[model samples]
Target: MNGTRLRPATFKYIESELYAYPDYQREINKIRDEIINGQEEQDENIGAGKNSYRKPGRPTERTVTRLDDNKRMNHLKEMVHVVEQVYDRLDDTQKKMIQLRYWSKRGANWEYIAEECFISRRTAFNYRKEIVGAIASKLGMN
Candidate 1:
């Protein structure tokens, strides 16, 4: 729970990622919607068959490869998934800890988080370690 198993940089990266989780989720949803819209347009054009041979319904290898190579989208999805996995495994108090530490508008400190959760400051820190370590391990950062 100390996050000692992860490299210092990785630990920091995971922390930043957790803090950015909401933004990342929004971006992911926006990207997905864009892709869907673009696909629909492409399907309409493909139905006309002016540039033929790609078929009307099937996606081409190039299209699939391009989607697979979208590093930003893939990374966002992975980060969101890892966070969700760790969050789901946490109890209500730990969930509250994450919400306080990462999602609070006022950027609550350990003391405030401990007070809100009815735990000691040390316990709040420990919850952070457990959550961060879980995320790092899920991300193969250990």
Candidate 2:
């Protein structure tokens, strides 16, 4: 998929999954910060260690990826909004299906969701497909 379409779907899925449990947001933020800090430290170490370059050359290329705080915050905010919208429209059954399939870290399949919901596996698969289609349609996603 193209970047523009993929980003919204990703944001929606992330946001919806994250909001299901408030503690998840805190954990995610902490993990993100740690990753960013680790990258920054690694970058600093690399810069300090490299000294034998060509005479009067341009600075060595950096390998780490970095995002300014404003951009990061804006992306997070957009994700939160997208998730909230998706969550609001869902019926209880659809919400539970989404939560089971995505929000739960264990990552349940149709058989599992069906067993949990006390339905046949085929029914579970159909429900999942229908819900996914509904979510995509509601969000104007692919």
Candidate 3:
């Protein structure tokens, strides 16, 4: 009760976030390969005159930016899987709360979760604590 610690809940959220993005990870590797190849080709043509440069083509600024964006998207995707796994064993209410807090676009908070479930904020907090503890125990990280 000291300083309102929610270490377990925070940990569960983080773990779930990590598990959510398997597809993103796979896509990331492919993007990385494209980026690397682009860079290599760019280097090869740097001093080979405009015509040679035209053949392999330089790595465009847009390509670099797109690759970076794809990487970030992949990271977010992975986090979604991690969150799903962490909340999988929770009760329906607890699962909904976690999904709202971590997955939903509106960025739901304890107050929102409480309102949606017709419970007090304190009750919502307790539910989060219980669900997180379960997650930690299941993952052998308790």
Candidate 4:
């Protein structure tokens, strides 16, 4: 796929939340890992990919400045803020569902979420759909 292609999974990840970890926590962990691992390996075939890449240093030398680590952290923070705003607008029941489904490390599974929310699995699924839709509308996301 092209760099900017909008895939179905993008919406899935946004709406259903793709991470097993708490929101923003995964990204924080990623930033930490990057810092510990140092710079990413250079893409040797700079101009050979679908997009042309101009070398930064000597014509033969390729230098990649790693600014995306910061961008990713900022994006994570913004998403967390939007989610918090939406979460605040939710009713008590919806908030309970979200907490059961997203916050607790052990309760962060569908079966556990259904159990904690005092609803059948099917009902939980439908509620999740509605809940995520409301969040999306509030956040202008997904």
Local distance difference test values of all predictions, in order: 0.79, 0.55, 0.60, 0.60
User: lDDT score, residue 76, model 4?
Assistant: 72
Instruction: Give one digit per residue, the lDDT tens place, for model 4 in 61-132.
Output: 212234344777666766776677767777776677777666655447777777877778887777666656
The best-first sequence of candidates by lDDT reads 1, 4, 3, 2
Model 4 stretches with alpha carbons more than 4 Å out: 1-8, 15-69, 105-111
Q: Score every model by TM-score.
A: 0.76, 0.45, 0.43, 0.49
Give the CA lDDT, 0 to 100, for residue 75 in model 3.
60
Evaluated at residue 105, the lDDT of candidate 2 is 46
Q: Per-residue lDDT for 72 in model 4?
A: 71
Better of 3 and 4 by lDDT: 4
lDDT of 1: 0.79
TM-score of 1: 0.76
lDDT of 3 by residue, 17-135 (tens): 43443355666667677765654533554577655635434457656766667756556554545445666756777766666665563456678889987789999877766655554
Between candidates 1 and 3, the TM-score winner:
1
Judging by TM-score, tell me the better candidate of 2 and 3.
Answer: 2
* Backbone N/Cα/C clashes per model: 0, 0, 12, 0
Candidate 2 wrong stretches, greater than 4 Å: 1-24, 27-69, 120-123, 126-141
Error of 2 at 110 (Å): 1.6
lDDT of 4: 0.60
- Which digits, one per residue and each the tens of the lDDT, describe model 1 over residues 115-137? 98999999887788778888887
